[model samples]
Target: MSIAESVVRTIEDKGAGAFVESYDPAEENMVINLGPVHPSTHGVLRLVLELSGETVLDCRPVIGYLHTGIEKECEDQTWRGAVTAVTRMDYLAPFHNEQAFSLAVEKLLDLEVPPRGKYIRTLMSELGRLSSHLVWFGTSGLDMGAMSAMFYGFRERELFLDFYEMVTGLRMNHGYNIPGGVWQDLPEGWEEVCANIVSIMPGRIDDYESLLTENPIWLERTKGVGIMSIEDAVRFGATGPIGRAAGLDWDLRRDMPYEAYGELSFEVPVASEGDVYARYQVRMAEMRESIKLVGQVMEKMPEGDYKNMDPKIMPPPRSELNRSMEAVIHHFKLVTQGYTVPAGDAYAAVESPRGELGAYVVSDGGTAPYRCHVRDPSFINLQSLASMAKGGLVADLIAVIASVDPVMGGVDR
Candidate 1:
């Protein structure tokens, strides 16, 4: 859409919500509300901006519009049920949510998932990483005036989502990852589908770089705009692409290997400039690395059972229930009350597409979790927005927000 057309559409969509309350137009400088539903802020985020003409003097991110109180809701559910709750926290990276929650519960139980399970988890997580970055790339491009990238991204994303649906029977919030392992084994021809995605993505990513990396307009909009210093990134607890863009060369997949990341060989991409362009480059490089991980995972996917053998944690098969009354009772209990986790607290962190998505869970030797809290990267990484937007033009704040890539579901959780 043309800039003028985009403006008219935005005004129409926002309608009465665009109006500022109890304000004066006579004031020298104006405080404007960007949106509780603005397109640029990304995902129902509101930015109250004190603007000097087109320059932004201050930016206060207004959040909680998407809040669902998921953390508190997690406490109300069983150990396994917490996975279902958290999977909705970051709807974009649902697998990461399930992975982190499962890992935490597993840690508390002192359970080690089988090698095949570990490899599958790693494989799915990397695919999620690629899926999320594609979204960021698309929306970031749209925010920065590159509309075509959005089309390319969603096109590729559908194929990736198809792979997810084949495994879990759902697309968005698949609670496929469980505490013991995955929900089930891979479906037939899963490897071929995975390999096809791996084959197509690399070349398409190259296409993205060719379109935007050196394009004068793209560089002009992104380079030196919304720069984050190494100090601020660390102080703000920013991880993943945002942290890597700021010269913080730390990836939990490499630095603190969980699942099968340690067994894989891949490079952690980094950039020193810490600007929108730097973040863009970091994410792009990471996509290539994810492709490498995908290849390794597809080829070396271990052979064995997916979930753990323990009947207490994983419910008995339906076939077994027909023959044995004990199996029938176990399945009923597992479905209704869920499994008991030992009395202890554990925290697990995974390198999500955005950043470090950590889950902290406390068990009271019961079916339900005593408490559960997610250290969502979106919630923390969002703090850097005001700092990044403070002296820049109002137009650039959108690019900054896109680079931070804060998923509002996670943020409001």
Candidate 2:
């Protein structure tokens, strides 16, 4: 008889009770809820984990605990006003959300924002990217027990936001980018504040590397934990740093250019490790590239009308209303009824800090959107958590979630 047959015969003779008794029930599996309320989650994300002792057998991420119906809310607002709602989707990469939505509206309207507007959008997107990474870095460090990283990361973010406030008049969710272009031109002294931030960030990044990249505890916790194979990452639809870490080697900024990304030269960093450490390294490198792009945008930024000068789409300047009766009527109509887009649908995507942030907008020749749907990267990237966490120690699961860097606002929205 074959060895398999002999073993089967023995098991048949011994019976089901004997087989059941062969292994400890405690070692079989234990189901536990990790959170809808945990810090490492970065927002209200609950993960159901099946544990075989401390080893994760399987994980199911439970999302929507923080849902605010942002997509649905977008349809209620005017085309230009939708930015206020969509900007809240990612929470961290608000500019990217606005950019994608604005680009989609522009596509539906068949309008191009002026060169200076395009460059400004690009600059803000990069700055938002840096801000997003800093948050990720801070939280990842906190999750891993490197307390200093949080402080350092937020320090950079505060200075970054100071520049944001200078231009848009709000640090977060500025509602700055609109359908035709931004809400206004870059304010006076924006260059000086931006220039100082760009100058000091390079040395700070070096300091961050020294603290965590080579630290024994950080290396031990993150180096090989939560390994996702390149094939699995692709199958799971993982993108951005998570995808790049698995050797995807594709950045929408480089592969699929948007905004002024085509004009700005930068490197797309990729790693084959597909581990928590690889994700960390990928984000760190991306921050450097964003800093470089910010510098380029500032240097080459053109001077022109920030918003498209089309009176049908953009309201005439407040100053123009004082002089011209036609301008008065234009501003009143735009503020009240809003501009109607041509009846059509369009999808525009930008490389958000997390991954591919896409907006699909439907216009029915109305002041408001017929339908607006956001393909948030947080939602897409969350699918990989189970794959990354399975077969890893339970403790490292925190590191895995942090490495993915999901913003619950985006996922649940």
Candidate 3:
């Protein structure tokens, strides 16, 4: 059964009253509000935990602190301009959001990106994956009281962000990936720069493993804590490292290839233990896999037109715009009015560092989309919290929340 169906079943089997009961015979259960502001909850999420002392009997996640009506806003912007809004939905893995939105637009336009564009996209996406995992590692460690690990992880992540800014002008919210292809080709000396960074990252990852993987305190804090069975993880709609750690090998990049992912080879890491340590191990392995994919994309880099030649779909080259009046006009029209799409619906998904990041887009044969909805993995993954947190110590609650790594931007968006 699908994840949604599984959640419904679990809810049905374990009735609401079983998890929570009245605090007083004459009153309903005491609802403990755990933050639209608490540090442990992460990013402005309020959890209504029905608690009997320190033990959580039941929990309901209250979102919307970061909600920006981004999906509704997408319906008003031009197709090319919408990337900026969507990228902010999952701030850590912006490229996946861009890729999903762009792919859906490409499906509407029926345009194919050139070989060079595809390889660049693969490189960027991998970098994004690595950066996101780094944040997860760092913050999860900090949340569990591993202060040094947090600093170390962010240190490496800064380097990755530098590479991102070099290629895409902006460190985040890069409207680089357009409908037909990427915004521009890689800058000069970019390959050597990227290669140098790639060579150094594995050693850094090794450093992280040395610090935490076998450390007695780290192990105690994480291993076997907040255990969720494989069945429960799938039932809760967990994805990315959270689900994969529980032995759910559901990576959209591998299972449903898009862009140049099919041409590249990488392993999807899975661990049977669905606990904090297992999630950490899965993300660590995934970082290595992302590095491998980036290396392959660099080696197999191709030469061709970056964007599609179709004038209606893509804007004219800058050189052409400067020299030709017609080219200038075309560029203006493409930017202001946007390219029209056929009246139909398309769903495009990518294996984001978080999970199956998907976009469901509908067009009414107009310049703007009729409807756009995102199937955010973080939003779905957060659903499992009550299941994992129950029957565990209050201290383990922090680890459980960190393990899932639900960025409220994605959840609330």
Candidate 4:
């Protein structure tokens, strides 16, 4: 039977008595409501766990607390303005969100990003992945009672955020990515700056691993907990480290090359153990792979236009806007009215830090999208909660949830 079918069967068989009861049979079932406010839920996620003492009988993840009508909001904004809305969907990995939206827009325009632009994008996206994993490692450690790991992970994450701030002027919600290409070119000395980060991060990753990789406490908490096989993961649509940890060799960057990823060299780490430690190992190895890609980007850095030069699609150069009336008018019109796209539907998928984040956009040859929806991986992957947590102790529930690393913003958006 499929995972969904199995879940229904389990719920039907085991939950019939509980449903008939007027109130939760607290003493009999040992029912516990795990956090609509719990920090480990990632954000406003609640799990209604029907349990007998410490062992979970069934699990239902409760979401929708952070929904902001982002898809509906996109309908009101011009295509250019819609990036801001989608970027907020996966706040931790906003670059992937922007990349998916940009890819869809590029498909609509029949536009091709220049080699340099693609390379720069790959660099930034990998950096964003590293930043996101750092947050995951930090917060997961905090959830598991390793407080110092949180500090160490965030300390390393700040370096990447500093690089982002240097490039985009904002620490987060950087509207740096726009349709056709990025908003601006890489700043001067950007190569050196990126190289420096690449040089230092591997050792820092080792530091993080030193704290948790073989530590007896961490191993006891994570190893052999929340195990899920490759078949189970694929059936449930899990991706990124969650799927990879189960020996699924699926990564959109490699399987479906988007942007400049085809030219990059990096390993997709997989662990067959399919446990919480395996997930942790996959993410740690991915951090190293990201560092390798950053070095490659710096080595092959090309020189070219960052944004498209097409006047209709891209904004005119600032120099042209100062001296040319035509340039000023074009810029004004593009910003205020936005460019139109062909009437068609397109989908773009990127391997977000959490999982495979895909955007499906439909355009009716208008400035705004006819319909916009995101296939948030966290939302889909969270469905496997019962599969992983079914027979595990309540304590293991926190560890399993942390390993999956569901961002509620992505889930509820």
Candidate 5:
């Protein structure tokens, strides 16, 4: 269909909520900016809103406010070192970012990560998902005027951050997932700590649901508001919670297994409402699944090397360097010059909390990548904002933005 036909159809279909409403030409449509600074925009996102009274007529997302050119910077660093930059793209789900870049590089080298390493990656990735979703749950509640949900969400999220610090030594943007595997093995007594975390999550999720799921105010604000049809969601490239909420039953983890996902079992949470409430339901269900996956990883955790032992890609162990002069030289060269990848390009994607996070790497048989690009779900999911917000109340727009959950770091990267 033509652009005009689509716009008219959208208007006609929307009925009382139509975006293109007939208004007096003499009374000019009000133009307003929602934010590059507003809290609900979810970090440096500006929505140029054309409004008639309090209803949104047109919404245009103005991004690049937080752009740091990280993709270009990745090209300047060694392929192994690029994870540092990639992890910072989606600050909320940093491990997924790291995993995507690492997987792409591993594909280029035809390297297989050890079973233990894959399990560790899977464990960390799921923990990261929990962390990301917790923040979303809290912030979404805060947006709807339920202040306590914000505090509760952050409180639960801190536990996972502690777990991250215990394992990776950093809470956010930890470059733990390297090309061949993880940076190091789990710390002593990690299994006990992980078990405790998963065990308590079901009750905590119950707490979250009790607070907002059936609350009359939340239901009034969210149900039937900011609805997106499955077609519009796909056209807008919305994925993750948003896509699943719209009845798009596509998940990269289940459909395209990576790491230890193929060996693990978990259900993908899906909903058909495609509203703010449906988005909430999808994410909440996902957190429960993440907890289940974490428990499975602990039970099925394998025993083996945590990293690839290849001399070409990995630096010699510290024990080896003490006995052999060649090990010393190899370690020095690997640290300073990095390993060379065969001339080729590869793309690897992982299911992130927000959506599909992918990395594309090109090599010229050199240490550094010739080109590096990330397909961030936040960037693509942000496109659905206009469709969701169009014809909705200005207040409802805040809820819609919160539901979409576009992190500017990823969107502008």
Candidate 6:
């Protein structure tokens, strides 16, 4: 019988006290609520699971519990202000959100970011990638009941967070990557700090690998659990580590280079396993790659303007404002009214840690976006949950959710 039919029959039998004398196999079929508030779900995601005994027969992910309507709110903010809204979506990898939005606005304005600005943006992007993967590693370990891995992952992640605060003045939701370029240049002593991070990060990754990569329990829980074939991944629009784990062999950094990514060289990690373990392996390799990218940025760091100096788009420096009445007036006008873009629309994407994070913006010759939308990977990737969760034991559902790593802020936004 269908699960629905089984449920009806079981309920009918229960009302008549049929179970007082005998039990029915159909009674074994059950449905359960997994989240919207539970730990191991990663965010405010609700999964309605249909089960037969301990095995999941079907799974449905219900989202929007954390929705704040940031996308719609973007329509009300000025071009320069929208970055603040988008940055909050992923929260874990806010730089990618800002990068995607900034790139789109720049495209709309036909603006160009200088070499130094591009490099700085690239530097932060990779650092953000490292921070994001570290959280994923820690949380994934937590989901798998490996307490030590969580401690290790977060310990290393704190270093990157320090770097973020030094650069952006805030660790998360930093409106650092503006439309013209970055809001400011790298502060003094940035080189020493960045060098210090890359120096220790590789060894730290090795530590993580040693802890969980070959642990028999880790392998048993993740090796063959939550497998999603490459064909299914593509159809469901999975990307980043999820698609890479399935052997999709595509990465926007390499395939569709942007910012300073084209100038830098790094391998896109891919595996054919398409299982929970493969997802873990790919992200671990990516953290190593991000470290390399950060090192490259430090060595090839260029000297130039960090933000486009367009008087209409960028406000005058505070130093200049005190010296020149013209600078003061210009700054006042720009801050109050903001710059306008020509009538057009554009879409720009960056390979976020989650996947292809894209921002689409439309201009109506106004200070604010006429329309704005983001193709958030977390939201798209959540589609694959049903496919991966079904036919797997209920205990393995946590691993599957962690492997996908959907951030609800991005998903619901």
lDDT of each residue in 101-218, candidate 5, tens digit only: 9999999999999999999999999999998999988888898899999999999889999989999999899999999999888999998889889888999999989998999999
Could you tell me which 10 consecutive residues in candidate 3 have the lowest summed lDDT? 15-24
Window of ten residues with lowest summed lDDT in model 5: 15-24
CA shift at 16, candidate 1, in angstroms? 10
**Each model's TM-score?**
0.93, 0.93, 0.92, 0.93, 0.94, 0.94
For candidate 6, lDDT tens digit of each residue in 110-229?
999999999999999999999888899999899888998889889988888888889889978999999999998899999988989988988888988999989999999999999999
In Å, residue 159's CA in model 1 sits off its true spot by 0.7
Residue-level error in angstroms, candidate 6, position 304? 0.6
**Measured by C-alpha RMSD in angstroms, how accurate is candidate 5?**
5.4
lDDT, candidate 4, 1-413, per-residue tens: 43323443554467533332222454456445677787778889877776777787777886777999999999998898999999999889888888888888888889988877788788889999999999999999999999998998899889899999999887887877777889888888887778888889999889899999999999999999999988899899888899999998999999999888888878899899999999999999999999998888888878888877899988898889989998999999998899899999999888889888999999999999888899998999999888999899999999999999999888999
Global CA lDDT of candidate 5, please?
A: 0.89
What digit string (tens of lDDT, one per residue) describes model 3 on residues 11-65? 4466423332224444433545566677877789766665556776666676778
- lDDT for 384 (candidate 1): 85
Considering TM-score, which of the candidate structures 2 and 6 is the better prediction for this target? 6
For each candidate, what is the lDDT?
Answer: 0.89, 0.89, 0.84, 0.86, 0.89, 0.89
Residues 1-413, model 2: lDDT tens digits: 42223433444476423222133375576556666677777888877666778898777776777899988888899988889999998999999999999999999999988989999999999999999999999989999999999999998899988888888989999899998889899988889889988999999999999999999999999999999999998899999999999999889999989778889899999999999999999999999999999999999999888889999999998889899999999999999999999999899999999999999999999999999999999999999998999899988999999999999999988
Worst 10 residues of 4 by lDDT: 15-24
Q: Which residue pairs collide, candidate 3? A: 35-46
Which pairs clash in the backbone of model 6?
none
